[model samples]
Target: MKHARPLPAYMVTRYHGWKATTHAENKGWYRRLADEGQRPRAMIISCCDSRVHVTSIFGADQGEFFIHRNIANLVPPFQPDGSQHGTSAAVEYAVTALKVSHLVVLGHSSCGGVAGCYDMCSGNAPELEETGSFVGRWMDILRPGYDMLPEGDDEARTRALEKVSVTVSLNNLMTFPFVQKAVEEGTLSLHGLWNDIGEGTLEGYDPDVDAFVAI
Candidate 1:
Protein backbone atom coordinates (compact mmCIF):
# COMPACT_ATOMS: atom_id res chain seq x y z
CA MET A 1 0.00 0.00 0.00
CA LYS A 2 3.06 2.26 0.26
CA HIS A 3 3.41 4.54 -2.76
CA ALA A 4 6.68 6.21 -1.91
CA ARG A 5 10.19 5.28 -0.85
CA PRO A 6 13.32 6.99 0.44
CA LEU A 7 15.34 8.85 -2.14
CA PRO A 8 18.12 6.97 -3.88
CA ALA A 9 21.64 7.57 -2.53
CA TYR A 10 22.82 9.24 -5.72
CA MET A 11 19.76 11.51 -5.84
CA VAL A 12 20.13 12.43 -2.17
CA THR A 13 23.79 13.28 -2.70
CA ARG A 14 23.01 15.41 -5.75
CA TYR A 15 20.23 17.20 -3.87
CA HIS A 16 22.60 18.09 -1.07
CA GLY A 17 25.19 19.35 -3.54
CA TRP A 18 22.60 21.52 -5.28
CA LYS A 19 21.22 22.79 -2.00
CA ALA A 20 24.69 23.82 -0.90
CA THR A 21 25.55 25.59 -4.12
CA THR A 22 22.84 26.37 -6.67
CA HIS A 23 20.03 26.72 -4.17
CA ALA A 24 22.10 28.72 -1.77
CA GLU A 25 23.14 31.12 -4.52
CA ASN A 26 19.60 31.55 -5.80
CA LYS A 27 17.79 31.64 -2.46
CA GLY A 28 16.53 35.21 -2.96
CA TRP A 29 15.45 34.61 -6.56
CA TYR A 30 13.70 31.42 -5.50
CA ARG A 31 11.81 33.26 -2.79
CA ARG A 32 10.73 35.96 -5.24
CA LEU A 33 9.53 33.35 -7.75
CA ALA A 34 7.58 31.57 -5.07
CA ASP A 35 5.91 34.78 -3.91
CA GLU A 36 5.14 36.24 -7.33
CA GLY A 37 4.35 33.01 -9.13
CA GLN A 38 5.63 32.03 -12.59
CA ARG A 39 5.03 34.23 -15.63
CA PRO A 40 7.03 32.45 -18.28
CA ARG A 41 6.86 33.92 -21.77
CA ALA A 42 7.16 30.72 -23.74
CA MET A 43 6.01 27.11 -23.57
CA ILE A 44 8.14 24.27 -24.87
CA ILE A 45 6.75 20.85 -25.71
CA SER A 46 9.71 18.48 -25.77
CA CYS A 47 10.50 14.78 -25.77
CA CYS A 48 10.95 12.73 -22.62
CA ASP A 49 14.41 11.71 -23.79
CA SER A 50 17.04 12.55 -21.16
CA ARG A 51 19.50 13.81 -23.76
CA VAL A 52 17.12 16.57 -24.82
CA HIS A 53 17.93 19.25 -22.26
CA VAL A 54 15.45 22.02 -23.06
CA THR A 55 16.75 24.67 -20.68
CA SER A 56 20.42 23.93 -21.27
CA ILE A 57 20.06 24.11 -25.04
CA PHE A 58 18.61 27.61 -24.79
CA GLY A 59 20.80 28.70 -21.86
CA ALA A 60 17.52 29.61 -20.16
CA ASP A 61 17.38 30.89 -16.63
CA GLN A 62 15.09 29.42 -14.00
CA GLY A 63 11.38 30.23 -14.46
CA GLU A 64 12.05 31.57 -17.93
CA PHE A 65 10.19 28.82 -19.76
CA PHE A 66 7.21 26.56 -19.12
CA ILE A 67 8.09 23.06 -20.36
CA HIS A 68 6.10 19.88 -20.89
CA ARG A 69 7.67 16.59 -21.92
CA ASN A 70 6.02 13.48 -23.36
CA ILE A 71 6.67 10.73 -25.85
CA ALA A 72 7.95 12.11 -29.18
CA ASN A 73 7.03 15.66 -28.07
CA LEU A 74 3.65 15.11 -29.73
CA VAL A 75 0.51 17.24 -29.51
CA PRO A 76 -2.69 15.38 -30.18
CA PRO A 77 -5.58 17.01 -32.01
CA PHE A 78 -8.23 18.59 -29.84
CA GLN A 79 -10.55 15.94 -28.42
CA PRO A 80 -13.23 16.97 -25.93
CA ASP A 81 -14.43 13.47 -25.17
CA GLY A 82 -13.89 14.16 -21.44
CA SER A 83 -11.10 11.56 -21.09
CA GLN A 84 -7.86 12.37 -19.30
CA HIS A 85 -5.20 13.82 -21.54
CA GLY A 86 -2.03 15.09 -19.86
CA THR A 87 -0.42 16.57 -22.98
CA SER A 88 -3.63 18.29 -23.99
CA ALA A 89 -4.10 19.67 -20.50
CA ALA A 90 -0.62 21.12 -20.52
CA VAL A 91 -1.27 22.79 -23.85
CA GLU A 92 -4.55 24.19 -22.61
CA TYR A 93 -2.95 25.65 -19.52
CA ALA A 94 0.01 27.09 -21.38
CA VAL A 95 -2.05 28.72 -24.09
CA THR A 96 -5.24 29.70 -22.26
CA ALA A 97 -3.92 30.24 -18.74
CA LEU A 98 -0.27 31.12 -19.03
CA LYS A 99 -0.80 32.97 -22.31
CA VAL A 100 2.68 32.09 -23.48
CA SER A 101 3.71 34.32 -26.36
CA HIS A 102 5.50 31.54 -28.17
CA LEU A 103 4.87 27.81 -28.26
CA VAL A 104 7.49 25.41 -29.53
CA VAL A 105 7.39 21.72 -30.34
CA LEU A 106 10.90 20.38 -29.99
CA GLY A 107 11.84 16.94 -31.33
CA HIS A 108 15.29 15.41 -31.47
CA SER A 109 17.44 12.97 -33.38
CA SER A 110 17.52 9.25 -32.51
CA CYS A 111 14.27 9.45 -30.58
CA GLY A 112 13.08 6.02 -29.38
CA GLY A 113 9.44 7.10 -29.66
CA VAL A 114 9.87 8.09 -33.26
CA ALA A 115 11.80 4.93 -34.01
CA GLY A 116 9.01 2.85 -32.51
CA CYS A 117 6.41 4.72 -34.53
CA TYR A 118 8.46 4.22 -37.69
CA ASP A 119 8.68 0.49 -37.07
CA MET A 120 5.02 0.28 -36.14
CA CYS A 121 3.96 2.02 -39.32
CA SER A 122 6.26 -0.21 -41.33
CA GLY A 123 4.66 -3.34 -39.81
CA ASN A 124 7.97 -4.23 -38.12
CA ALA A 125 6.96 -3.62 -34.48
CA PRO A 126 4.16 -6.07 -33.82
CA GLU A 127 4.30 -5.59 -30.08
CA LEU A 128 3.54 -1.90 -30.46
CA GLU A 129 0.48 -2.67 -32.59
CA GLU A 130 -1.43 -4.15 -29.68
CA THR A 131 -4.59 -2.30 -28.61
CA GLY A 132 -3.52 -2.20 -24.96
CA SER A 133 -0.12 -0.72 -25.75
CA PHE A 134 -0.11 2.85 -24.39
CA VAL A 135 3.00 3.74 -26.35
CA GLY A 136 1.49 2.47 -29.59
CA ARG A 137 -1.66 4.47 -28.98
CA TRP A 138 0.24 7.62 -27.99
CA MET A 139 2.41 7.34 -31.08
CA ASP A 140 -0.64 7.27 -33.29
CA ILE A 141 -0.24 11.07 -33.36
CA LEU A 142 2.73 10.65 -35.66
CA ARG A 143 1.09 8.11 -37.99
CA PRO A 144 0.38 10.77 -40.61
CA GLY A 145 4.02 11.77 -40.55
CA TYR A 146 5.07 8.18 -41.22
CA ASP A 147 2.76 8.00 -44.22
CA MET A 148 4.33 11.16 -45.63
CA LEU A 149 7.93 10.02 -45.17
CA PRO A 150 10.06 9.98 -48.29
CA GLU A 151 11.67 6.78 -49.48
CA GLY A 152 14.95 6.06 -47.70
CA ASP A 153 16.89 3.58 -45.64
CA ASP A 154 15.83 2.98 -42.03
CA GLU A 155 18.44 5.38 -40.68
CA ALA A 156 17.38 8.22 -42.93
CA ARG A 157 13.70 7.49 -42.48
CA THR A 158 13.97 7.53 -38.71
CA ARG A 159 15.85 10.83 -38.76
CA ALA A 160 13.30 12.42 -41.06
CA LEU A 161 10.41 11.31 -38.89
CA GLU A 162 12.01 13.01 -35.93
CA LYS A 163 11.48 16.35 -37.60
CA VAL A 164 8.16 15.30 -39.00
CA SER A 165 7.01 14.70 -35.43
CA VAL A 166 7.63 18.35 -34.66
CA THR A 167 5.70 19.51 -37.71
CA VAL A 168 2.81 17.23 -36.87
CA SER A 169 2.67 18.62 -33.35
CA LEU A 170 2.78 22.17 -34.61
CA ASN A 171 -0.11 21.44 -36.93
CA ASN A 172 -2.08 19.76 -34.15
CA LEU A 173 -1.51 22.68 -31.81
CA MET A 174 -3.54 24.81 -34.18
CA THR A 175 -6.44 22.42 -33.85
CA PHE A 176 -7.11 23.63 -30.32
CA PRO A 177 -9.71 26.40 -30.46
CA PHE A 178 -7.94 28.46 -27.83
CA VAL A 179 -4.61 28.02 -29.54
CA GLN A 180 -6.08 29.01 -32.87
CA LYS A 181 -7.74 32.06 -31.38
CA ALA A 182 -4.57 33.17 -29.60
CA VAL A 183 -2.57 32.75 -32.82
CA GLU A 184 -5.15 34.52 -34.94
CA GLU A 185 -5.25 37.46 -32.53
CA GLY A 186 -1.46 37.82 -32.93
CA THR A 187 -0.89 37.04 -29.28
CA LEU A 188 0.74 33.65 -29.85
CA SER A 189 3.06 31.99 -32.34
CA LEU A 190 3.94 28.37 -33.05
CA HIS A 191 7.35 26.97 -33.85
CA GLY A 192 8.76 23.55 -34.69
CA LEU A 193 12.31 22.54 -33.86
CA TRP A 194 14.54 19.48 -34.12
CA ASN A 195 17.63 19.08 -32.06
CA ASP A 196 20.60 17.03 -33.23
CA ILE A 197 21.81 15.80 -29.85
CA GLY A 198 25.24 14.45 -30.71
CA GLU A 199 26.12 17.04 -33.32
CA GLY A 200 24.94 19.91 -31.10
CA THR A 201 22.99 21.34 -33.97
CA LEU A 202 19.53 22.95 -33.80
CA GLU A 203 17.09 23.35 -36.66
CA GLY A 204 13.91 25.38 -36.90
CA TYR A 205 11.16 24.57 -39.31
CA ASP A 206 10.69 27.20 -42.01
CA PRO A 207 7.27 26.97 -43.58
CA ASP A 208 8.35 29.34 -46.29
CA VAL A 209 11.12 27.03 -47.43
CA ASP A 210 9.40 23.85 -46.26
CA ALA A 211 12.60 22.74 -44.53
CA PHE A 212 14.34 22.71 -41.20
CA VAL A 213 17.04 25.35 -41.31
CA ALA A 214 19.96 25.38 -38.89
CA ILE A 215 19.57 27.93 -36.11
Candidate 2:
Protein backbone atom coordinates (compact mmCIF):
# COMPACT_ATOMS: atom_id res chain seq x y z
CA MET A 1 0.00 0.00 0.00
CA LYS A 2 1.14 3.51 -0.83
CA HIS A 3 1.08 6.17 1.85
CA ALA A 4 0.36 9.83 1.20
CA ARG A 5 3.29 12.11 1.92
CA PRO A 6 3.06 15.59 3.32
CA LEU A 7 4.52 18.49 1.38
CA PRO A 8 8.17 19.27 2.06
CA ALA A 9 8.66 21.86 4.83
CA TYR A 10 10.47 24.24 2.47
CA MET A 11 7.65 24.04 -0.07
CA VAL A 12 5.04 24.53 2.64
CA THR A 13 6.81 27.60 3.90
CA ARG A 14 7.21 28.97 0.38
CA TYR A 15 3.54 28.40 -0.41
CA HIS A 16 2.39 30.20 2.73
CA GLY A 17 4.68 33.12 1.99
CA TRP A 18 3.43 33.36 -1.58
CA LYS A 19 -0.19 33.14 -0.42
CA ALA A 20 0.35 35.95 2.06
CA THR A 21 1.93 38.14 -0.58
CA THR A 22 -0.89 37.41 -3.01
CA HIS A 23 -3.56 38.20 -0.45
CA ALA A 24 -1.84 41.39 0.61
CA GLU A 25 -1.57 42.68 -2.97
CA ASN A 26 -4.92 41.49 -4.29
CA LYS A 27 -7.34 41.20 -1.39
CA GLY A 28 -9.49 44.08 -2.53
CA TRP A 29 -9.47 42.93 -6.16
CA TYR A 30 -10.37 39.42 -5.05
CA ARG A 31 -13.29 40.72 -3.00
CA ARG A 32 -14.56 42.75 -5.97
CA LEU A 33 -14.19 39.78 -8.31
CA ALA A 34 -16.03 37.54 -5.89
CA ASP A 35 -18.79 40.06 -5.28
CA GLU A 36 -19.27 41.11 -8.92
CA GLY A 37 -18.54 37.59 -10.19
CA GLN A 38 -15.50 36.65 -12.22
CA ARG A 39 -15.69 37.43 -15.91
CA PRO A 40 -12.32 36.61 -17.41
CA ARG A 41 -11.82 38.19 -20.80
CA ALA A 42 -10.03 35.22 -22.34
CA MET A 43 -9.61 31.45 -22.23
CA ILE A 44 -6.22 29.87 -23.00
CA ILE A 45 -5.82 26.33 -24.26
CA SER A 46 -2.22 25.33 -23.57
CA CYS A 47 0.12 22.34 -23.30
CA CYS A 48 0.91 20.68 -20.00
CA ASP A 49 4.60 21.54 -20.54
CA SER A 50 6.11 22.97 -17.38
CA ARG A 51 8.28 25.35 -19.37
CA VAL A 52 5.34 26.85 -21.25
CA HIS A 53 3.28 28.39 -18.48
CA VAL A 54 0.34 30.36 -19.96
CA THR A 55 -0.14 32.85 -17.13
CA SER A 56 3.56 33.80 -17.01
CA ILE A 57 3.85 33.90 -20.79
CA PHE A 58 0.85 36.18 -21.20
CA GLY A 59 1.46 38.19 -18.04
CA ALA A 60 -2.05 37.30 -16.85
CA ASP A 61 -3.10 37.88 -13.25
CA GLN A 62 -5.35 35.48 -11.41
CA GLY A 63 -8.97 35.56 -12.68
CA GLU A 64 -7.84 37.24 -15.90
CA PHE A 65 -7.94 34.07 -18.00
CA PHE A 66 -9.64 30.71 -17.90
CA ILE A 67 -6.98 28.07 -18.62
CA HIS A 68 -6.97 24.46 -19.76
CA ARG A 69 -3.85 22.33 -20.12
CA ASN A 70 -3.51 18.96 -21.84
CA ILE A 71 -0.97 16.78 -23.60
CA ALA A 72 0.19 18.64 -26.70
CA ASN A 73 -2.64 21.09 -26.13
CA LEU A 74 -4.88 19.22 -28.57
CA VAL A 75 -8.57 19.99 -28.75
CA PRO A 76 -10.50 17.03 -30.10
CA PRO A 77 -13.62 17.54 -32.19
CA PHE A 78 -16.81 17.42 -30.14
CA GLN A 79 -18.54 14.05 -30.03
CA PRO A 80 -20.82 12.20 -27.65
CA ASP A 81 -18.48 9.30 -26.88
CA GLY A 82 -19.60 8.70 -23.29
CA SER A 83 -15.95 9.09 -22.39
CA GLN A 84 -14.03 11.75 -20.50
CA HIS A 85 -13.59 14.90 -22.57
CA GLY A 86 -11.20 17.02 -20.51
CA THR A 87 -10.21 19.57 -23.12
CA SER A 88 -13.65 19.73 -24.68
CA ALA A 89 -15.28 20.18 -21.29
CA ALA A 90 -13.00 23.14 -20.57
CA VAL A 91 -13.88 24.65 -23.94
CA GLU A 92 -17.59 24.21 -23.28
CA TYR A 93 -17.32 25.81 -19.87
CA ALA A 94 -15.20 28.71 -21.10
CA VAL A 95 -17.50 29.44 -24.00
CA THR A 96 -20.87 28.53 -22.56
CA ALA A 97 -20.49 29.18 -18.85
CA LEU A 98 -17.77 31.82 -18.62
CA LYS A 99 -18.63 33.38 -21.97
CA VAL A 100 -15.04 34.56 -22.44
CA SER A 101 -14.54 36.97 -25.31
CA HIS A 102 -11.34 35.36 -26.57
CA LEU A 103 -10.10 31.78 -26.86
CA VAL A 104 -6.43 31.29 -27.66
CA VAL A 105 -4.57 28.08 -28.52
CA LEU A 106 -1.02 28.35 -27.26
CA GLY A 107 1.69 26.14 -28.83
CA HIS A 108 5.37 26.03 -27.99
CA SER A 109 8.59 24.77 -29.58
CA SER A 110 10.26 21.43 -28.70
CA CYS A 111 7.13 19.76 -27.35
CA GLY A 112 7.86 16.14 -26.34
CA GLY A 113 4.33 15.00 -27.19
CA VAL A 114 4.61 16.53 -30.62
CA ALA A 115 8.02 14.91 -30.99
CA GLY A 116 6.45 11.56 -30.13
CA CYS A 117 3.85 12.10 -32.82
CA TYR A 118 6.59 12.82 -35.32
CA ASP A 119 8.42 9.69 -34.28
CA MET A 120 5.26 7.62 -34.66
CA CYS A 121 4.73 9.13 -38.07
CA SER A 122 8.29 8.29 -39.16
CA GLY A 123 7.89 4.70 -37.96
CA ASN A 124 10.93 5.03 -35.72
CA ALA A 125 9.03 4.17 -32.55
CA PRO A 126 7.87 0.67 -31.63
CA GLU A 127 4.37 -0.17 -32.83
CA LEU A 128 1.67 0.19 -30.24
CA GLU A 129 0.32 -3.17 -29.05
CA GLU A 130 -2.85 -1.53 -27.80
CA THR A 131 -4.83 1.09 -29.68
CA GLY A 132 -5.94 2.87 -26.50
CA SER A 133 -2.78 3.73 -24.57
CA PHE A 134 -2.86 7.39 -23.48
CA VAL A 135 0.07 8.66 -25.56
CA GLY A 136 -0.84 6.65 -28.65
CA ARG A 137 -4.41 7.87 -28.59
CA TRP A 138 -3.40 11.45 -27.93
CA MET A 139 -0.90 11.36 -30.81
CA ASP A 140 -3.75 10.37 -33.09
CA ILE A 141 -5.06 13.91 -32.82
CA LEU A 142 -1.92 15.14 -34.64
CA ARG A 143 -1.84 12.35 -37.25
CA PRO A 144 -3.15 14.58 -40.00
CA GLY A 145 -0.40 17.09 -39.35
CA TYR A 146 2.17 14.29 -39.29
CA ASP A 147 0.87 13.03 -42.61
CA MET A 148 1.36 16.52 -44.01
CA LEU A 149 5.07 16.67 -43.15
CA PRO A 150 7.82 15.63 -45.58
CA GLU A 151 10.21 12.90 -44.54
CA GLY A 152 13.54 14.33 -43.27
CA ASP A 153 15.97 14.57 -40.36
CA ASP A 154 14.20 13.51 -37.17
CA GLU A 155 14.95 16.65 -35.15
CA ALA A 156 14.06 19.16 -37.84
CA ARG A 157 11.05 17.11 -38.91
CA THR A 158 9.76 17.01 -35.35
CA ARG A 159 9.96 20.81 -35.00
CA ALA A 160 8.17 21.31 -38.32
CA LEU A 161 5.55 18.77 -37.35
CA GLU A 162 4.98 20.57 -34.04
CA LYS A 163 4.38 23.84 -35.87
CA VAL A 164 1.99 22.14 -38.29
CA SER A 165 0.19 20.50 -35.39
CA VAL A 166 -0.57 23.95 -33.95
CA THR A 167 -2.33 24.92 -37.17
CA VAL A 168 -4.18 21.60 -37.20
CA SER A 169 -5.29 22.05 -33.59
CA LEU A 170 -6.52 25.54 -34.41
CA ASN A 171 -8.66 24.01 -37.17
CA ASN A 172 -9.86 21.34 -34.76
CA LEU A 173 -10.95 24.03 -32.26
CA MET A 174 -13.23 25.57 -34.87
CA THR A 175 -14.92 22.19 -35.39
CA PHE A 176 -16.23 22.15 -31.81
CA PRO A 177 -19.96 22.93 -31.76
CA PHE A 178 -19.73 25.47 -28.94
CA VAL A 179 -16.74 27.15 -30.51
CA GLN A 180 -18.40 27.22 -33.92
CA LYS A 181 -21.55 28.72 -32.52
CA ALA A 182 -19.67 31.34 -30.51
CA VAL A 183 -17.61 32.43 -33.50
CA GLU A 184 -20.65 32.53 -35.74
CA GLU A 185 -22.39 34.83 -33.27
CA GLY A 186 -19.26 37.01 -33.02
CA THR A 187 -19.27 36.86 -29.24
CA LEU A 188 -15.88 35.10 -29.22
CA SER A 189 -12.65 35.37 -31.15
CA LEU A 190 -10.01 32.67 -31.74
CA HIS A 191 -6.27 33.18 -31.84
CA GLY A 192 -3.27 30.86 -32.28
CA LEU A 193 0.08 31.61 -30.63
CA TRP A 194 3.51 30.02 -30.92
CA ASN A 195 6.26 30.57 -28.34
CA ASP A 196 9.88 29.87 -29.31
CA ILE A 197 11.41 28.76 -26.04
CA GLY A 198 15.08 29.10 -26.86
CA GLU A 199 14.70 32.43 -28.58
CA GLY A 200 12.30 33.83 -26.01
CA THR A 201 10.14 35.21 -28.80
CA LEU A 202 6.37 35.03 -29.21
CA GLU A 203 4.50 34.87 -32.49
CA GLY A 204 0.85 35.26 -33.35
CA TYR A 205 -0.94 33.78 -36.33
CA ASP A 206 -1.65 36.38 -38.98
CA PRO A 207 -4.54 35.13 -41.05
CA ASP A 208 -4.20 37.95 -43.53
CA VAL A 209 -0.48 37.26 -44.03
CA ASP A 210 -0.97 33.48 -43.82
CA ALA A 211 2.00 33.25 -41.45
CA PHE A 212 3.11 33.64 -37.86
CA VAL A 213 4.44 37.11 -37.14
CA ALA A 214 6.48 38.00 -34.08
CA ILE A 215 4.48 39.93 -31.51
lDDT of each: 0.95, 0.84
State the lDDT at 57 in candidate 2: 77
> Which pairs clash in model 1?
none
Q: Give the least accurate 10-residue stretch of model 1, judged by summed lDDT.
A: 1-10
* Per-residue lDDT over 74-142 for candidate 2, one digit per residue giving the tens place of the 0 to 100 score: 888767689998888888989999999999988889998898887776676656314766887887889
How displaced is residue 147 in candidate 1, in Å?
A: 0.9
What TM-score, over all chains together, does every model reach?
A: 0.98, 0.91
- The predictions' CA RMSDs to the true structure, in order, are 0.8, 2.0
lDDT of 1 at 53: 95
lDDT of 1: 0.95
Candidate 2 regions off by >4 Å?
127-129
